[model samples]
Target: MSEYEFSSDAALLDGDWVHRTLREHAYWAHDRSREVQDAANAGSRCFGVYERGTGRQVAFARVVTDGATFGWLADVIVDPERRGLGLGKLLVEGIVEELDALGLRRTLLMTRDAHTLYGRHGWEPAAPVGDWLVRWRH
Candidate 1:
């Protein structure tokens, strides 16, 4: 389901299919316009997966990083129609490679689902953030 192509010159960050893809992936997406605008402007490193031959995006993921030691994965999504295809793993594998290239040794994320997928990549549960407000009320 996923085959990531590394591109430093990513397509410009814009609303473009950001929100639509979110909805298509069954994420509780609200305010399509806002979701698109916010994510595109968040300044995170984004990985976009395109369907072979068609060049249409089938998955999306973003990583917020410090470019040195840490990268936190967030907002990983794959279209519902493509769910059984292993697209999510490809998105993450791409992010891992990018962060590794940038010399980041610590990659982190919080997920309530897909634990087995992450575990397959050798990630294990660790202590949660110390007194951190991990949720977004927005």
Candidate 2:
């Protein structure tokens, strides 16, 4: 068993923690505003990884989906202090499993780095069709 609990419950998410982490560390969301993050969460399927004992969110990710054919994953971040414990892999794996259950035609995400992490979860560069099929098989 892992030390973290993964959840898709928006209610369990810590928006302030997410906002601050992304604002300070994430290259893509460094300048993103709270309003935008809130709105994004409101419209997307949000996922978080929490410390099992304290229920404190330690990681976050969200996917903008139509609940059918497509999903666009965004804002994937793990608390810097907790990075090497495999929390990121756990989070992304959970998200992929959730999406796979939806049976969506495609799920997409973009990253400037961390290719190795995503790749381990079956994500690939460009040509989303292959990536979708690859992830679906797992």
Candidate 3:
């Protein structure tokens, strides 16, 4: 098993790293402004995955939850340099465990290419493509 450690400490979140990774790499939030990113981090239950000894953040995920019945997982990203190290799976697993502790009955996430990863963690396609609706504002 990998030695990475997962944390739910918003204080441990490296905002600059999160912002840069999302802006430069993640397709979903590439256009998000730094202020918006900060706001989202502030509002969600942010998780940070760190190197075992260095304490450097290498992965991140967040959940917006009501602390009971519903959670929406978002912004799951691993450092590009650390991809294939199983940190993504570790991050997701940690998030799910936290959510389960909250007694959340439903958790949701949208991914363009990671269906298989999430499936292993008990997530299923909540709706078929074109059946879900969004009201994204720019």
TM-score of each: 0.75, 0.88, 0.92
Candidate 3: where are CA atoms >4 Å away?
A: 128-132
Candidate 3: give the clashing pairs: none
Task: Point out the higher-scoring one by lDDT: 1 or 3.
Answer: 3
lDDT of 2 by residue, 1-138 (tens): 377899998999898999999999899888889999999999999999999899999999999999989999999999999988999989998999999999998777889888999888777877644554543421
Residues 1-138 of candidate 3: C-alpha lDDT, one tens digit per residue: 357898998898999999999999999988999999999999899998998778899999889888889899999999999899889988988888889889999898989999999999999987677876889766
After aligning candidate 2 to the native by TM-score, how far in Å is the CA of 27 from where it should be? Answer: 0.8
In lDDT terms, which candidate is top?
Answer: 3
**lDDT of candidate 1 over 17-98, digit per residue (tens):** 6666665553455445665647553778777777656666767777788888887877677767778777777777777777
Compared with the true structure, model 1 gives a TM-score of 0.75
TM-score of 2: 0.88
Clashing pairs in 1: none
lDDT against the true structure, each candidate: 0.68, 0.90, 0.90
- Which residue runs of candidate 1 sit more than 4 Å off their true CA positions? 1-9, 12-14, 23-42, 128-138
Clashes of each: 0, 0, 0
